[model samples]
Target chain A: MTLKKATAYRLSDNSKALLIFYFVIFAVMLSFILRTTLFTSSNYGTLGGLDASSMIFIFVVSLIFAESFKMLQQNGCSRKTIFLSFVYSTIILAVVMAVVDSLTAMLMDIITSNYESGFFQIYQARYQSMRSAQHFFEGLLWYVTAYVMMGAIGFFITNLYYRMGKLLKVLVSVGVPVFFVIILPILSNLTGGAIYEGIKNFFDFAWGFSHGFNPYFSMVSASIFSVILGGLAFLLIRRAVPKQ
Target chain B: MKGIEIRNLSKSYGEVVALKDINLKFGGDKIYGLLGRNGAGKTTLLNIISNRLFPDSGEVLVDGETAIENDSAQRKIYMMGESNFYPEGMTIRQAFRWSQRFYPSFDRNLALSLVEKFSLGLDKKMKSLSTGYNSIFKAIVALATKVPYTLLDEPVLGLDANHRDLLYKSLLESYQEHPRTIVISTHLIDEVANIIEDIVIIDQGEILRNQSSEEMLKQGYTVYGTAAAIDNYIADKEVIGFDNLGGLKTAYILGEVDNIIPPELEVTKLNLQKLFVVLTNRRALK
Candidate 1:
């Protein structure tokens, strides 16, 4: 019952925001299509893809952690219940968003066929590069994995803020970037570029893992990162106290 | 057995202690007034009971079961705290709807009726409501939750006299209709003096006094007479506080009132507010 209520509450809270977001996205796309088709000499049918979806998904996830967590806890929800409900809600949101993105792509495809110039379906044609059933399912997997990874990162960051004291918050805010931008560079120079090589290699590996031809590898890596982040978030939430 | 039992509960915020090894219980289906000054750990205790905050030590049990992270145990409890926990942009009606979803026994009809009685707009968003209405909205929810143990921290905050009176009447009416343990944490002692069955006075993070209202009132008495006579009468007893104006004096004595009265002195009942001030002030003075 706790899980059910928590999920329902989260869904109710965010559903309106999601709807407005989708409506705006659709309106923008439609307006661009109309302006290009009617006013331009040549039809350049290009709709900006699901690139904005990831950012929106991350914002939604952050809202869940930053606000929903405290709200639920204050309303007698246990940490375990909230964490579980958030997981379920995020999954449902990801699936729904992915399906909507796919449907939008298909609709764009239909419109592009009617136009003299083939539509530049950014997400389907450029990003996924395929329209087969297998590719669609793979795209779905990518979308879900990307959403979960970003959502987990958001959740982790929010939990960090929620649990940290003022001193810790200030330290983390200033110290983390300073360590990477200044201290790490100095250390790399002093270490005869060994630290730089290590950092380069780590980024190279991450880039390869994410940009791999086989989407499954990227999906697996994203899932792994999501699990680590989600696990850390759960730990923080378990000990989190509501704001006074 | 059927109420909240807090044992060895201790909570501290760095150098400051919020609750200090406080052991307390709210038993039976009686109304309890959790009286305390500001920062006396009233809200802290309620938060811990509802699992919004964790105690540094000890545990809270509901009907003999641990309430910490226990869904079944927490289900029996409801708390309308000072903080606004509802989602932003949520209307009063939506809050009531969600409350029904969370608390299975929540009475939506009663909540709506209370909204009507209070003249609160159901469509008004929580953030838009005035401070008093915000409290009234939560108070209405607490009254309609139908939970076994309801903890209200500063439930009447920002309320005017008439609204507060109406809330108190509604609370009493609900309690009469459905007998349940209701703990009201507020500074308005006189307002709730007659309504509350038990009084739990907390001062400086410790339980200063915990007893039935009648019993607690019985422990203190005020003697009025000439300053010299009052001083003589309170010489042998524990004098909590005293009020003096020229020759006339009123001394708040903590103990049973003497059966044999001095002809010059007048004895009266120790009101809750005066007694609370005296008792809590004694701690501050120390």
Candidate 2:
């Protein structure tokens, strides 16, 4: 409907602002990573380092952007429209970040490698020393995986916000996740190494797209989980009765 | 005939029943005053009719087509809910834009005209606006949507007397230009008495009274005289309510007063506000 489009456009304005904000923050962080030896091309000399940082970065940005999606729905925009709009915004943000990060990484790689080689070759050769095709596909999968999961989390939060009792709406909006954050680490510690290792391994595998670590399977698993969780969340939000 | 027909509708939130076995039909080119006391399911019923909520049983038909999840039916009905559902950061202009997108019939020019008429600042953020202004913004949207079946639940909430009057005028003007089924649920019966064609009094989730305003008025009469005289006249009659001051008394009695009351008694049209107070009070007592 026209209203849905209007809602989406209004929301996209805010989304665009947030996207820019994240872009600036990550760009600055990329500058810092360039100056640090830990992230340099010479260090580790594998796709693992770049993949890890990119996946983590994508995940964190997705989490923050989830807030923007929630704002869209809260603003009298329908949940279904918001869900649909989010897919587009997420992809847009992903593409923007991919371009910006790659450009910055390429520039930094050129300068650093050129200085190390003692040759002022125009458009430094090592700058074009890209990861294998497998790694590129893995990175793409990881990006989509993280974003979809975050979008699902966004829907989940919206559902929880509606399901909460009147008094709990405001409190739970911030409090529930905070409570979980405080509990999860303690629970992991108490549960010991096997559980901790499993959790760590899961994240590692989920983010391990650059090493040809079964990108399709990891993404498919994440997508399935996301769909199931997102569906439940949609149901909850849809049937929520506004309480006095 | 172009109106809403809700049959055997039931809704409950947990153990609290909002509506039960509700059957109602609201016709076109008419203004219906959906009067009810608080928690009497007026909002709940309106929500269901507008497709904001689902019923546990039965169906809501608009022109004989199920309204639930039916886009064509939903497109015809525009609802302004009691609660504030507008986003916080949006300005009046932005809200208008959003409404225009959702309702193809939404008249942006009309919305803008209302904005000007109301002297509302278009760029002021909703969160920054006063509660009254927030309601005004939504009222403007509802009026401008120009949908066939418009249901306004407490449309004048937080509005000042001047704006309320303006709203009534604008509503009447809009209806005259494009006649539709307009149902208003509000406590201000007297304020809307003149414009309301029909009245539906809901009490404790039951339809206590539903009839034409003229018919409803005709069914009851008010007698004013000395306390003793009024008391004597209504002694065996069904008195809806009575008010006494010193020796003066006014008693509203149900049914015709033509042959029952004394010829010396001063009989007059029952003020809808007073009649509602009496009927609802009587219903509550039962």
- In angstroms and one decimal each, the interface RMSD of every candidate reads 1.4, 5.1
Q: What is the lDDT of residue B207 in candidate 2?
A: 84
Candidate 1 runs further than 4 Å off: A35-41, A51-55, A113-129, A175-212, B223-251, B260-267
- Give all candidates' CA lDDT scores: 0.82, 0.69
Q: Per-residue lDDT of A78-169 in model 2, one digit per residue for the tens?
A: 44555556555555555555554444444555444321211112112223353334434444544556556655665566566657667889
Residue-wise C-alpha lDDT for candidate 1, range B1-286, written one tens digit per residue: 6789999999998999999999999989999999999999998999899998889999999999989998788888889999788866788888888788778889888888899999999999988988899999999999999899999999999999999999999999899988899999998899999999999999889999999999988988889999999888887998877888999999888888788989999888887898899888878999
DockQ of 1: 0.58
What docking tier does model 1 reach? medium
Candidate 1 is scored at a TM of 0.88
TM-score of each: 0.88, 0.78
